[model samples]
Target: MLDYKVRTYEEAIEVIKEIGFLPLTQLVPNYPSLDSITSKEHWHTGSELDPWLWRAIFPGDGVAAYGKFVKKKSVLISSELLPLTRSTLGSPRSVNERYQDGLMSREAVELYTLISENEGIDTRVLRVQAGMKDKDMKKPFDNGLLELQGFMDIVVSGTKAKTNEAGEKNGWSSTSFETMDYWAEKNKIGKATIKVDKAKMKLKDHFTSFCSPETMKAIYKIFKF
Candidate 1:
């Protein structure tokens, strides 16, 4: 288990590297949430610490944060291990497959197409461009974003603070999303060396090594494997 007192981005990265992948909050048995493991007293009371970690690890030209795993939150999967995980999860579908599979909703296709066409985009701008600016579209828009992330078709590149009409910061940031292929290519990350079945077995063995049997059961339930 990681020392339950992470106080810095470096420490957080260390823990993530050790565990392979972890959630931002405590969920799976035996795995520690980023907040639960923080040593900073001020961070213990609420979710203030999460954004700091997000800002530090994402974007900036490296695959430091695997931003989609459980609960559509960040999952720290090291760049070295990304290929294996991607292989296990399966490849990103072509445009036709993505639309036809019934896995992606109409909003998801629109959002994904915008990101792909533009190379990358901030979430705030993406919503507007995708015609999801209406308040009623929030849930579907959010779900579409999560669905794309879950499928490994897209990933967060970084964050930009929301601003008011006066150009003042709103104290909240919107994440930037990009196609996984774009990010991987730009970063020079390679494709999976192993086949899907082999990747799955390897990933399972790796997970089993650190996660308890109960945790394993929970993982299986979540992934439905």
Candidate 2:
């Protein structure tokens, strides 16, 4: 017996691809069909679903995954997709169940997490963004995460300041760079190619390139993986 937690089926698929087993992972080891998870009550059969990608899909399913899997004193919780569950069954049973049945790679899940966190895009909306029609497009890719991860260094480091009614610095920054201008001025960063406020900012050809390493670090830190 075993238990697992995954937010959605797509996430499960993402994890599998991250680990370089997109096709096999999606097949549901032992060949469980899409309907199998939709119908079966127990997903963690203790035979399959033993990958880190599967562990992250629902890393918090302590009760549902752990309770059933950990029958004896020595229970190995690795090779899991999501977090360990202890009490709750899961969120949105119908939706997540379908997702849980699906398999993905941990790297894929992490990349997805980074993109959504960075863009502030909601996970639900991502389903549409990915347009995960076939297993191929839906399968994880290293390029997406690698490019994004590199940007993380600059996205995290940050500085902050505050202002008063007169529009003067009432005090030192109490928060990360008060605004994009503050980021530009302090870091000596040039205008970016894709600034939300100025269409002209795009003139830089590559907005991210213009950003200083510190600025990029700040951006990365905002979104935790």
Q: What TM-scores do the predictions have?
A: 0.84, 0.17
Please provide, for model 1 over 1-225, each residue's C-alpha lDDT reduced to its tens digit, 9 standing for 90 to 100. 444676666666666677666676666777777766875454524354553544435444474545665567666566666787777664545655867977668888888889998765888888888888999999999998888887777877877778889999977776888888788878888876688777777778777887778888976764445
Q: Could you tell me the lDDT of residue 93 within candidate 2?
A: 22
Q: Show the lowest summed lDDT stretch of 10 residues, model 2.
A: 81-90
- Candidate 1 lDDT score relative to the true structure: 0.71
* Candidate No. with top lDDT: 1
Sequence-dependent TM-score of model 1: 0.84
Error of 1 at 59 (Å): 4.6
Error of 1 at 163 (Å): 3.4
For residues 1-225, what per-residue lDDT tens digits would candidate 2 score against the true structure? Answer: 012233455545543323311221222232222223232443444324433223322213221111112111111121121111111111222222333665334443444454434442333334345554345644444333332222221111122335679888675432110121222334444333332323223212222444355543532332120
Candidate No. with top TM-score: 1
